[model samples]
Target: MDEAVKFHFVVDGNDFTSAGQASVQIKKNLRQLGIAPEIIRKVSIAMYEGEINMVIHAGGGEADVLIYENRIEIILTDNGPGIANIDLAMQEGFSTAPDNIRSLGFGAGMGLPNMKRYTDAMQIDSTFGKGTRISMTVNL
Candidate 1:
């Protein structure tokens, strides 16, 4: 693509049923754009994890996907209590999800780690009481 294509989605924090919808839509869009399956998978996984995090912790958020000729960028923004420790949060099996969320099998503390694993690059910006913004990119 000569110019970047963008897609925006609003996640509903009140409804767990709506989580992951943005990633699913992004996957379909990538497939339709003829992007490689592997790249699409990476983007989907990373974005899905971010989406779930927004729902479970951030009271929902906005996800924006930018499709470029050489890469794809996923931006997740939320206005919720920010992560206290980035290092600890990045560790596998480390989660702050509530018991109810865990009972539903949603929080395994693998969200950030898996997001990093699947994406080529990921960055997180958060403020303890303010909010968080995560940006991830996948090479095409």
Candidate 2:
């Protein structure tokens, strides 16, 4: 596409049923734009993880996606308690999710790591008591 297209969503915290809605919508949007299926899958997976993380830990948040000629950009921001240790949080299988969350099979401590893995570039900005803002880009 010659022009960039943007989409936005509001995530509802602690709402398991609605957690992946943004990703699903994004997937549809990408498909409608004729983006490659593989690319759509990767973007959907990454954004879904981020949305789940926001619900489980961040008490909900906002997600924005921009589709451009050369890349897809995603931004997730939340006012929930920020991650205490970025390095530790990035480690696979390392999670602080509550027991109730684990019972639902939602928190495997794989969110951030997977987000980074799927995206071409990822960045995290957070503070202990403040909040977190994550930005990710996947090359087209």
How do the predictions measure up, each by TM-score? 0.97, 0.96
lDDT of 2 by residue, 1-140 (tens): 37779999999996787789999999999999999998998899999999999998889999999888899999999999999999999999999999988998967889899999999999999999999999999999
Error of 1 at 109 (Å): 0.9
Worst 10 residues of 2 by lDDT: 1-10
Best by TM-score: 1
**Model 1 score (lDDT):** 0.93
TM-score of 1: 0.97
Candidate 1 residues 45-108, lDDT tens each?
9999998999999899999999888989999999999999999999999999999988889789
Looking at candidate 2, what is the lDDT of residue 41? 89
Q: In candidate 1, what residue range of length 10 has the lowest lDDT sum?
A: 1-10
